[model samples]
Every structure is written in C-alpha cells, then in structure tokens.
Target chain A: MLEFIDANCRLGRGPAPREGAPNTTEEILALMDRFQVRSAVVYHASAQYAEIMASNRRLKEETRGSDRFFMQWAVLPPVWDLFPDPEALLDEMKQNGVNSVRMFPAQFGHSMKRYAAGALLDTLAAHRVPVFLPFDQIGNWDALYELCETYPDVRFVLCSPGYRCLRWLVPIMDRCPNLYVETSNFLMHNGFRLFCANMGADRLVFGSGMPEASLAAAASQLLLSDISQTEKEQIAGGNILRLLSEVAL
Target chain B: MIGENVLRGEPFKGVFIFDIHAHIDATSDFELTDSSPDKVVRTLDALGIGGACVSSILSIHADCPLGNLHVKEACSKYPGRLYGYLTVSPYDPDTDLDGAFADPHFKGMKVHAAFHRTAINDPRYEPYWEYADKKRLPVLFHAWELADVRHIAELAPRYPDAKFIIGHGAMRTWEIKREVVKAVKHNGNIFADTTVSVAYDGAIEWAASQLGADRVCYGSDIPFYDCRHVVGKVATSRLSDADKEKILGENAKKILDLP
Candidate 1:
C-alpha cells in the first residue's frame, strides 16, 4: 500500500464532536496506523470555537515530542489587530515547525477579500507557505478563483469540494495554477484517473478528512485507482510533502 | 478475514461482494467521468465485486421510459453481472412495473422522493408500495433524514412482505444516525446501507453494533461514488470478519437472492 500523509485533519474535540470522533493524539495515531497514514497535518478545533492564538498554543503543547504529527495553525484576517503581526506570526510558525495554515473565514465571521486578508496573503506568499482553505468558507468558486489569482505565488489546497464539484472545479483549476485540491471527498467516479490525466498528479494531494470522515475512503481512491504507481505515490504523500518542503519560512 | 485483502490493497478474493445501491449513468448535476454500463462492470471486476444492483440516473431524474430501457439493455448485455432496479416515477403513479418485472434481471424498486418531489408515503406512492409488498421485493429509498426513517417505519408494518432499505443511512449528523437506529430497531423489515460520502471514522462499527450486523447492507452509490473506499471503510472496521462479511456481501446477497 502507498504511504499517506493526511493533509486535512483536526485535533481536539470541538464544541459538538460527533459520536465515534477521535480527539486525542493517542486515538488519532491508532487510526493512522490502521489506515496506513504515515503522518498527518492537523489543526486544533478549539481554534474555531475559542481563541485562535490560545488554541494554537495548546495544539503545539499537546502535539509536543510527536514527530508523526505536524501542526497547522488557524489564522484570521488582521482586522482590529485580531491576530498577531504577520512577520511575528510567520517567525513563530517557523520556530515552532508549523509549516501550513488553515483559514475559517465563514466561521470566524471575516472576509477573505483583498481589503481584509490582502496583507496576510502577501506575507504568506512571500514565505511560500501553503494555505488550506475549506470550500464552504470561501462561499463559491468565484471568490476562490479571485483569491488564487490575486495571490499567484501562494499555494492553496481546496478541501471538501465533495463529489459534485467536478463541473465547477475543472475550469477553475485550468485558470489557477497555484490552486490544488485535497482528495478527502472529491469522490467523483473514476475522478482520480481523469484528474491525473487532465491536471497532472502533482496538483492533487491525499487527505482523509479524518474524525469527521475516515481515512480508508480517500486512501482507497488512490490505492485502487487506475493511475500508475508513481502517480499514486505522488497523490498519497509525495505531493503534500513537496508542498510543505517548499515553505521557505 | 476479507479486511486482510483490503488492507494489502488487493482485490477481495474467496468471498462474494455485491453493491445494492448504485447508478448506471451520469446525473444532471455533474458528470460521472465514466458512467457507462461497461465501465461500471469493469470497475466491479477490478474490485472483485460479484455484481451490482443499479438504477438509471435518467430514470430517477427524468425520462423514466428511456432510463428503464437503458437499464434493461445493460442487464441484457451483462446477464448476471448487473441487475436492474425498476425505477418508478411519482408523477406517473399509474406506471406498470409488471412489464419490467417480467425479466428476471429486474430485482426491485428504487424510489427517489427527493428528486421526484413527492413524499415517500404520499397517496401516489401507495400503489407502487403495494406492488412491492405483493412481490415481496426490497424497496430502496433515497432517504437521508429522520423523517424518511419515520415514514419507512410507519409503512414497513403495513407492507410486511416488502423489505425497506434506507440509502445514505449514515448521512448528515450523528443525531440523525441515532434516530435511524431507533427507527430500524422498531421495524424488522427496515434496513440501512453504509453509503455516504462522509464515511466517518468508526461509523461502520457503530452501525453494526447498534443495528445488528444482519440489518445493515453494503451499498456504494456506484458511479455517483466509487465502491473501493466504502468497501475499505467496511472491510477495515473493528467489527468481526463475520459481521464484515455480512455487510460487505452476505446481507445484500441474501436480500437480492444472488448466489
């Protein structure tokens, strides 16, 4: 089986964790072992429900001494000095070994538009840090297209596009080279083969959407897909590995 | 035991695998990349699935006559490999399923109340429900909520001979799933499929323990979604091999009478 580095995962129990959802590091590690995930990039759910800074600090503390887990901080737009200074934040991330960041614009009640997130986006682009954006938070494809086009240097991984987003995804992907898609719920039939054929395997990354979803569903798409072994390897963990490595910060 | 094959990323061998909820062609909402019957069968062969019970996307969405024609022709082309679901339209309540049922390949009825804009228990669906009861057939519903489960619970007692399957049974929220368990527990004829894009961790295990292994069936919603991952979800669950065997194929095989 191909090794997987789950690019989308969440740590810590949310305000309303679903039944059978794993919250602790021990539980997640067991799931990882069973599902053939070598490692994972995760964010703290408390960052969504509580203060982002404190939750991110808790995430770093909780995941300390675990090489198998990589931390991804939840960031917000710098409105009313809501977040730390961009340079200072990047420096902290670099020191703490946090390479990627996720944004929850809808949940945080902020706009990812130029006026709100332009400064943060520019800083992220300068450092070459990849941003994980949920599909629902961006509202629609047009906003996503604009965000990608505006920050041509930054890498964006669109998560939870679902099985029905293919018609909308193809054109957007064609226009935005900086945009990539996670494989958690992109479950269109024969979609992996078709995507690799059209978009190249480099643009796709494997993500389990674990806890909320399972790892086997996304992992099996690459494992049983008609794509070549090398392509499968790229999608399973190679692509995300390359993205994280490109983070200059 | 079957999980060993799935864990090693190999096609399941020495066991029968059949998907009860699947579609043959593309829907209006999105393209299915390859929804042709040949491709569908090819996928089943690749995954070592013995067969799949499919309804045409066209049949449920629009054009029932033409859609049923597509299903009939596909079943003819691949005799035992593909089975047909005689999809009935709510608008055409007077539609005759007798002609469709004449062929042995036509196994059951598939109802999509969401698409047809009619409640499952509406007066128009009573005739079809009666028909399924008379034939002792399994009726698969495109149900994803508590209300749908409630409707099935109410109807299952009235139509004792007919089997009721709730498609996308693990959808939406955990509360809905708990309610689904409560409803299925009350109705012996009611069963649910482990088919949802959001295949949550331990969902298969939870469903098996709550609903009993026999009351749940394996369904992939194939072409709309792939079977491999959902198969992986069931195969790699914490449930015993016997329970996994039941969910992966045995339960569905018993329901469809496939040997």
Candidate 2:
C-alpha cells in the first residue's frame, strides 16, 4: 500500500510547543525523506512575524533548482499588518508560483478576521487556492467549517484532528467538501481506520509533526493500515498533487 | 500492564495486565502530570493495566505512603489484581515491628533514598536490613548510579543479613555501566529489578554469561511506561519461557515473599 501523503508536516520548533530541532527546513526535509515523502505544501512557525513569508522564501530558495517541493500560506502578524495591499502579496505568491496557505489559530488565538484576514481570503477565493488551518492541535472546528462552507471554493487543510472526539471531525467535514485532513499526530490505533471509513482516503493525507514523531513510524501507520492500494496512493501523494496542480503553486 | 506476545493480534480473554508500579490517590485531582494513590489505580485500570505493585504516598524518602493500603483495598475489592508495598523511609526508622510495618496488607518496603536524599548504604538504614533479615521481607531501593559496583560490592557484603533489590535495576544501564553486577559480585541477598531501560532479557543473558541468570528480576515500571509494551517485550524476548515466567510472574513473587 502507498505510505500516505503526509499533508500535515512541520518544521522549525527550537523546543516544544515552540520551534527547535525539527524546526529547520533541512531537518524537516530529512524527516520527510526518512519515510520517502516526495513534497509538502509548507508553512513556517508563528515565530518569524509573518513567518509565512519566511516559509514562502525558504520554499523558493530550496526548490529554485528543484520542482518537487512547494509553499503553502504562512503569515506572521507583523508582515501581514505591514502589507500595502493584501492582494499584491497574493499576486506575488502566485507569480512566484506559491500554492497554498497554512493557518495557525492557537498561536494567533482567533479566527482570521473577515476584513483584516477577510481581504486575504478574498484574494485566495479569487485565485481558488487552498488554506490549511492548523489550530495548534486544539483546533476550532466552528470557525474552520464556517470558512469552508462560506468560501466553498477555498480548500482548507486540517492537520492533527487528534483522537479525543473521533466523531467531531467526520461530521464537520460532511458539510464542507473543500475541507481535508492531514494524518500527523497520534495517527495510530483507531483514528486512521475512522478517517478512511468517513473522510475517505481521497481527503486524507500523511504528516509526521516530526522530531516529536518518526516519518517512517507515522507513514507506517497508513502504509501498514489495511486500506486499498489505489486509495492509499491518492492519500499518499496524489490528492496533494491534484490540489496543488489546480492552484498552479 | 502486560500483553502476551504469544497471543498478539489473535485476541483472547482481553488484555492480561500487571502494572509493576503505581501510587494511587483517586481523591486527588486527575491530571496526567502527577499521580495520587486512587487516581493511580483508576489510571492503571483505564490504561488496561490489570494489576500493579503500588507504593504509599507521603513519607520521608517519601515515595507514596498510602498506596499500599489502597492497593490492598483494591486487591481485596478487585481480587486477582493489584499488589501493594509499604513506604519505609530510611530517613525515618522502618519501625519493623510497628503496626504499619507489620500490617498484613503490605508485602514489602518501597524504600526511596535518592529522591529523599538518603544513602542506600547508610548505617541509619540498617534497621530495615535487620528487620528484613528477620522476616525475609525484600527491600526495594530507589537505586540509580549513586553506588558503583565497588559500592554495591561493599554494601552487599555488609548487608548479607537481608533481602534487597536495587530499584530501576540501576536505571537499566546495568550492561552499559555494569553497576549492578559490579556491586553484588554474586551476593545472593541482593537482587535488582528491570524497571527501566536495561531490564531486557538481553541484559539478563549478558549478566548470565558473566554473573548468571538468577541476579535479575523483571518489573514493569508501570504508570511511567506503557506496561503492555514493556511486558510484551519481556514476554516475547528470546529468553525461554522459564526465564519469561520468572520475569513475568515468579521472580516478583519470590522477591516480595508473596504466598
């Protein structure tokens, strides 16, 4: 079976609940390589003050001579506030061939504002790119599902749905076709089985939230799982490829 | 907590668990960071640990004071499960013949010296050896690397009068450090438990090749680790079932003087 497309991977946490070892771009890629992962739509930690730009710049720098890797949406509070026009950054990202966005509510502690964060959403909607919302492990489903339903066109990537309330994730995604999940944290036991049963392999991807976990171990959760080979391939890499291809990132 | 590798994925009578350590205080607040005597039991049960060797809470070396009483209560109440050990602070006298010391519920003494800043070889603690020597109650020490083989070598010679166990098996680096064997030099009165890293039968084999098989005993440093995982490792080790049986069930019984 395909190991799984770990859609939810991270880099640059110097220390726990913070950024350290697996926090650097190189460390993260090495982690991904351990499990033989091909590419990831990247996001920077909340430290860089618009770390999304840092994430974008790094992806560009790393992929300058390569084609497999790409960038997602990452933004720091400062750089976002200083933007002359939000659309300009969006256009610049598009021109630079960036693909998606990653949202961090736990770090910022609230939903992206409609007017302040709203304009950015408008730009993404205009471009039809996806936004990955990582609630720092304690996600706000109400806000995320609302974003997915409201935007309809924006693809929202949710990482680490976790194990506590299994039903909580599946039902939320029911109303939002654009919402997807990344299997990164606590992927063992029953959650992987539940995801394939409900979210379907097409909507699921692999991720290791590494340094705290092993890519081979996490990927093995899916690779070793009893899912169909075709579905496994799609979850492993095809889905992300499809999503990235649509956005031209 | 224990799972039989012989029965892995085949599914049987449910997970047969034996938690080798715990301190429950169920009345205390329930949080993952710390433990209370009652909460310890519930946590063990919650984690599918069928049985445990619980220590008391609140004492000088102070480990857990009431965990044994609680485990006795649990054992009487639950049956075929739960083992309790009383706290005996080397800082405070073991009070061997006292009601708490002689209480039938407890099988042994959970003596923690390092955490409470007492020496394993201190003469002040000799009362415990004297008492254990008389009654044959095995004493479990909070041993790490404080005493090298030379020190254990010294202590074992002096404490030939009592039954003793080095807690955490010298923090399981017995092979890496050889602190356990270097100390005992085949002193039959002293035994170590595999509660941490190096307790594997691999260590047992190396020890046997050098010191022989009877030196080490198996213990699941439960609550601190996934007991099922640890037991699975032990039960499925390359060691023979006789060795497995000793580590899994018999050695502990012999050490604690359990009927």
lDDT of 1 by residue, A1-249 (tens): 778899998888777666665657778888888878899999988886898998998887666568888889999877566678789899989888899999989989988877878889889989989999989889998889888888888899999898888878889999999999998988888888888888889989899887787786777767778888899889889999999998898
Q: Could you give candidate 1's per-residue lDDT for residues B1-259 as a string of tens digits?
A: 6777766667878887788898897777777768999999999998888899999999999888789889999999999899989898778865778877999998998998878887888878898889999999999999876787778888998998899998888545677787788878888888899888556777887788888999888899988887777877787778898998898789888777775
True contacts kept of each: 0.67, 0.00
C-alpha positional error of residue B105 in candidate 1 after TM-score superposition, expressed in Å? 0.5
Best by DockQ: 1
Chain A TM-score compared with the true chain A, each model in order: 0.96, 0.80
lDDT tens digits, residues B77-117, model 2?
A: 64545666666665455453467555565666676666667
Candidate 1 residues lying further than 4 Å off, grouped into runs, are none
Best by lDDT: 1
Candidate 2 CAPRI classification by DockQ: incorrect
In candidate 2, what are the lDDT values of residues A1-249, reduced to their tens digit?
243345655444433331222445665666455445677655444332344455556656653444545655564223435543656667777777767776665665544656446766766767768777654623566666666766776677787664333445667778778878776643323344446775677787666555443353355445534456777678778887788778743
Sliding window of 10 residues with minimal summed lDDT for model 2 chain B: B3-12
Comparing to the true complex, what docking class would candidate 1 get?
medium
Model 1 chain B TM at 0.96
